[model samples]
Target: MIQNSGIGRVLYETLLYLLDNGDEWILIGNPEFLKQLPGKRNTIVASHAPAFHPREFVGFPRRIINSADVFFTPNYNIPGGIRVPIVASILDLVYFDLPEIVRSPVGRWIRRYFARRAVRLSREIITISEFTRERIEYYLKPGVPIHVCYLGITRELRNQRADFLRGPRPYDFPYILYIGNVKRHKNLHVLLEAYLTARKNDFNCKLVIVGKMEGLRTRDAGIMREFAQLEKQGDIITSGYVPDNELYQLMAHTEVLIQPSLYEGFGLPPLEALYLGRPVVLSDIPIFREVYSDLPVTFFDPLSVRQLSAILENHSWETPTSIDTTLKSRELDYAAAAEKIYSVLKKYAG
Candidate 1:
C-alpha cells in the first residue's frame, strides 16, 4: 500500500525537492505511487514486494541496482545482495526501543537483525532527530558516521498562507485534534482514557483523531474498548485519512492539538500546529523536549490521566506568539534537508 504520512511523507517531500532541483534517481516500490512525482529523467522500477518481506532480498531488478552509484533507503529495510555503497536511514529505533510492541519473539529478533544489518551494511546512516541520534549511538553503537538531518516541515504546510483562516467546521462541535497512527507507543489508549475523564469533568469538546482505524481492534484490544465506548456515544470521531488542505483546516480550527505519545523520534503534528500558530499540548517526553522546548507549548505527563484531563478541561494555554516567524527562519524547509542528504550521497557515490 502507498504510505502518505510519517516517514513516507518525509521521504516524499525530500525526493520531490531532489527531483525538481536536479538528480537522476532510480526509484523502486509501487510505480503508481512514485510516478506522480516530477522528473522523467529519473527511472521508476516497479516492485510489488513490501519492505521486510523475504522476496525483497532479491526483488529489486538487477539492472536498476547495477546502474546506481550509491543506494540510500529512507528506512532500515536494506535489500539483500546489493553491491553498491548503501546509506540507510534509521528514523527511530521503534522496534528496538519498544520491543514489547512486536508480540512475537521471532518477529522481534528479525527486526533487530535487520536493524543491525542496516548499520553494518550502510556506508553511512541518516537519522531525523538528535534524540534518535543519541538512541542509535547508545543502543546500536554504529561506528560509521551518522548524520543528523532534522526533518523539515513539508512544502504544503510551509507554503500555506499565513492568514489562512480556519474554513468550515470539520465537525459541528468543538474538538481537540490528534493526527497519527494508532500504534502501541502512540499511547492513544491513555489519550482516550484521559479524554473520557475530561468529559466527566465537563470538558465539552469532541476528540477528533485523524488516521486510519482499520484493524485497531485486533492490534490493541484495550484501546479498542475505550474507543468503541467513546465512539458509540459520539464523543470520539475518526477521520480515516484527510487530504492536506482538509488536515490544515482541521488543525487550524481545532480547540487545541494534543500529542500524547509515550515515545517518538520526533513528533511532527505538534510542530505543524506550532507553525500554524495553534495551541498544542505535548507529552513530556525526552524527544519532545529536545526538539520543541524552545517553542511555546504545554507539556503533560503521558501516563497521568488526571493531569491531562484537567488541562483539557481548563484550556489554560494560549496560542503561541511569533511562532510562525520563528519556525519560518528555522529548520522548516525540506529543500535544505534534501541538499544536506544529497551532499552526503555525493561524498560516497562511486
Candidate 2:
C-alpha cells in the first residue's frame, strides 16, 4: 500500500478491523509487508506484483486462492485464476468521468476496460459514497448489487494528540491548508488564484500545501505560472510529505482547511479536519454536500476565484467547540465499514 494515500489508509483500517475480528484469511501481498500485520493466523501469499501490473492479472497463486471461500480486494483489479466468489471495491469513476485529466489514452482505456470487466465479474460491488454509486449506475449499469459503505476516519486521526509530536509548530504564521496533490481535477489552480486575491485584499495568511511535490507538473500553463510565482514569492509553502503525527498537528493548527475539488469519491481530508473541530471550506459539489452538509463547513463555487477569495478575506472561521452531528449517522469510522464489508464477503462466500 502507498502509505500516505487516502485509499491506503482505508485498506489499512479495514484490514485492522478484519484482523481484530479473528477470521481466518488468505492474504496476498509482499511477504515482508504482510508479516507486519497483527494477525498470526492469516496465510500470506507472496506476490511482488503491484496493483494493475500485468503480473497481478496472471501471476496470482492459484492454490492459495482456491483454498479461500471468497476472494476480496480493496480495488477493482481482479487477479486471474480465482474460482471462489469475488467481491471488489470500486472506489471511484474519476478516470471515466474526467478524461481531459487522464494524460495517457492507453492508460485510460485500460482503466475503463478493467473497471467494466470487474463490474461484470464481481458478485457485488462496494463504493464509498452515494454519488459514486449513482455514477456507477449511470455509467456502468452493473447487474450485481452495489453497496454504498461510507469510509471512516483513520486510527491515527482518531487518536490525535493536542501537542505536536515533532516538538515545534509547522509554521509560525497562520496558513490555509490544502491536503491533496496538484491534480487537474483537484482544482488547485483556482485555489491559488483565490489565495492571490485574498492576499490583495489583506488576508495575509500563507498557503500550505501538504503532499508530495516531487514532480509537480500540471497541464494548465496558467496554473503553473501562478503557482511558480506564489511559491517563489514565499506566499505558498509545500510540505513534501509528513507522517500522520505531524499531519495531525498541521491540520490542527491551520486557520481553515479548504478542499476545492471539482470531483471526488469522498473528500477525506476536510472531513478529517471537521472531525478535529476545525473549520472547512469545500467546493459546492454534490459529493461534498452529500457527505458534509450536516457538518460545520462553508461552500463555494469551485470555478469562482473571486467568491472564494472574498470568503477567505471576510468569513469568520471559528473552530466549533463540539461537533454534535455524527457525520450524517454513517458510522464514519473503519469498524462499521469493515463490519459491513465483512458481512458482504461472508454472504457471497456461502
Candidate 3:
C-alpha cells in the first residue's frame, strides 16, 4: 500500500488490522504487493494486477471488477471506469504537502491527478485522521463523503514485556528510541542536537535511531549524508532496519520513544509506542496534540534543540505525571470503525 514501502507502516498495519478481524476479503493489486499482505482466514489475494499508470485505468481491467462484489482499497485509488462503487483510504497527502522531499515533480503531479480522480470515482473516502480528511477536502474537494476512521494498533505492538532482561544497555548505557524515516520534515537534526546536549549535561543515555535513511532527492540525500556522518561519530545507534518483533523489543526496552517530525499525518509509531505503554516525547505540533491529547508525553518544539534536550533530560521510563490512555487503549474503537466501513461497502454491494 502507498508505494510498497514498509516505511509507510500505517498502510500495512491497516490491512493487517482488517485481516486479523477475519473479514471475507480479496486483495487485488500488483503481484509484488501480495508478499506484504498478512495471512488470516477468509482472505484471498488475487495478484494478477500488473502495475500501470492510474490514467491507463480509463479502460480499467474488468477482471478486477468481476473478482469482488465490492471494492475496498486500503491505500490506493479505484480505476475510474470500474462500475462498482469503491472505497479507498488516503493516509495523508504528504506528497502534496511536501512535494520536493516526498516525490519528484512528475511523480507528484501524476499522483495528484490520480488522487483527484480516485475521489471522483470512489463512493466514499476513508482517511486515517481528521487532519488528513481536512487536507483532502481543501485540496481535492471531492463530492464523496470523507470518513475519519482512526487506525488500530495490533496486540503484538502492545505486548507486555520487560524493559530489559537486565544489563547496562548498549553503546554507553540507557537510550531513547526514534523510529521511522529521516525525511526533511522529520526534524532529525533537532533530535541529534538535543541528544548531544543531554550527553554533555551527564544524562547517561545513548540515542538509538531504529530506521533506515530515505529520501532520494539531492537535498534529501544531503540530509541522509549528514545522518550517516552522525552515525560514524557513534553518538547514536542507527540500527539500519529491524523486524517488527525486534522493533517491539526495542520499544519495550527504551527509556523513551520520541517522534521529532516537523509534520505528520497521524504519527502511528508514537501511538504504537504508547500502546506498548512506553513514554513518548513529541514535537509540539497540532497533529500530535490532536491525536495524543489524553496520552501522557513530553512536548518540545521540533526546531528547538534546547527544549527537546530539556524534555529528554527530565523524562523517565519509570513514571510520568499524567497517563490517561482512554482515547487510545479503550475509546478509539477499531471494531466500530470496521463495522462502519462495512456498512458503507454494503450499501454499494449487489
Candidate 4:
C-alpha cells in the first residue's frame, strides 16, 4: 500500500490499471491510504509504513522475490535486502540536484541513500518526464532503463462543470489559480511576491492558492505568515486542501494556472489545467520545457519575482486544442504501461 500523497495517488492509479487488466497486486502502506483502495478480492492491503521510515522487513512476502514477481515502489525508497525485481519510480534527484533546497541533514541522507538503492535494485525505472529521466541517468549509473510515463488528468476533471454561478464571487473576480503544497521547492514565497508586485500595477486578478499546508519548514512557515497577513488585507485567498469538485470548478473557470516550482519530475497541476482547457503559466525550468514545449504554456523564471509578475500581467487565456489529444495519448500510454508491467511480472512469476 502506498501512502496517500502525490506519488501515492499515481501508484494507486497505476495499480488500478494493472488490476483492471487482470493482474493481482498487494498494496503495502499507511492504513489511511490503504483504506482508499477498492475492496476487491485481488487487492491486499499490507501494514502501514510511515513516510521516509525504513520499510519493515517482518511480514508476509518475507522473501521479497517470493512475495511478488516485480515489486513496484513509487517515489523512491525500497526495502533493503529485497532480492525482488524492484521497479521504482524516481521522481527527481532534487535533494542532490538542488541541495540548497533540502533543509535537514537526516532528510538529505535518507533521500540520497534510497535514490542510490533505487538505481541499484530497479530492473526497470519509471519517471514522470524525460528531463527527470536524464537527471536520474546523470546521477546514477548509466544505461539503466528509464521509462517516461507522463501523468494524466483524470477524466472527472474534463466532465466538470464550470459552476461559477454559486461560488462566493460568481464571476465577480478574475482569479489566477495555483494548486499544490507550499513547500520550499514549490516556491510559493516568490509566487506570492510576484502576485503582489503584479497587483501593484493594477492587475485586477485575484490569486487563489489551493493545497494542504504540510512540510512547511519554519522559514517557509514564516513567509506564509506574511502572506497570510496580506491575505487578511485581501491580496490572496488561500483555500487550503479544497475538495476535488471545488478544485476542478476553479480550474475550469480560472484565467490561468500558475506553477512556479523550482523543480518537478512532472508537474501534474499544469496538465490538469490543460485538460480543463485552461491556459498555464509555468516556471521556465528545463523539465517544464521538456514536457510542455509542444504545448502553449507561458514560462517564467521561478527565481525572479519580476519575471513572474511580467508574465502574469501580459498572459492571456486561450482554450487549447491539444488537450483532448493529450488526454487520449495518456490513456494509450497508461494501457501500454500496464502491459509492460504485467509482462515483467509474468517473466518472473513464481
The superposed Cα distance between candidate 2 and the true structure at residue 5, in angstroms, equals 1.2
lDDT of 4 at 3: 45
Go through the candidates in order and give each one's C-alpha lDDT: 0.81, 0.82, 0.68, 0.71
Model 1 worst lDDT window (10 residues): 161-170
Error of 1 at 14 (Å): 0.6
Segments of candidate 2 deviating more than 4 angstroms = 2-4, 161-168, 214-226, 316-321
User: lDDT per residue, candidate 3, 263-290, as tens digits?
Assistant: 7878877766665667888888878888
Clashes of each: 0, 0, 0, 2
Q: Estimate, for each residue in 1-350, the C-alpha lDDT of model 1 and write its tens digit.
A: 23737778888988887777566788887888899988868888888887778888777686678678988888887877788888888888888889988889999988889989999998899998889998889888898998887765777776773534545666788999998887788877777878887887898999999997754643456656867888988889888898878898788788899998989988888877777778999999999998788888999999897888889889976567656555556665678778888888898666
Q: What is the lDDT of residue 243 in candidate 2?
A: 78
The most accurate candidate by TM-score is: 2
Expressed as tens digits, the lDDT of each residue in 46-138 for candidate 4 is 565565665543343445344766777776767666767777788778898887676788888878987887788778787777788888878
State how far residue 23 of model 3 sits from its true place (Å): 6.3
**Cα RMSD to native, each candidate?**
2.5, 2.3, 4.2, 3.5
Per-candidate TM-score against the hidden true structure? 0.92, 0.93, 0.81, 0.85
Compute the lDDT of residue 261 as modeled in candidate 2.
96
Off by over 4 Å in 4: 1-3, 30-43, 55-65, 158-172, 213-226, 316-319, 329-333
Q: List residue ranges in candidate 3 displaced over 4 A.
A: 2-24, 29-61, 159-172, 214-230, 316-330
lDDT of 4: 0.71
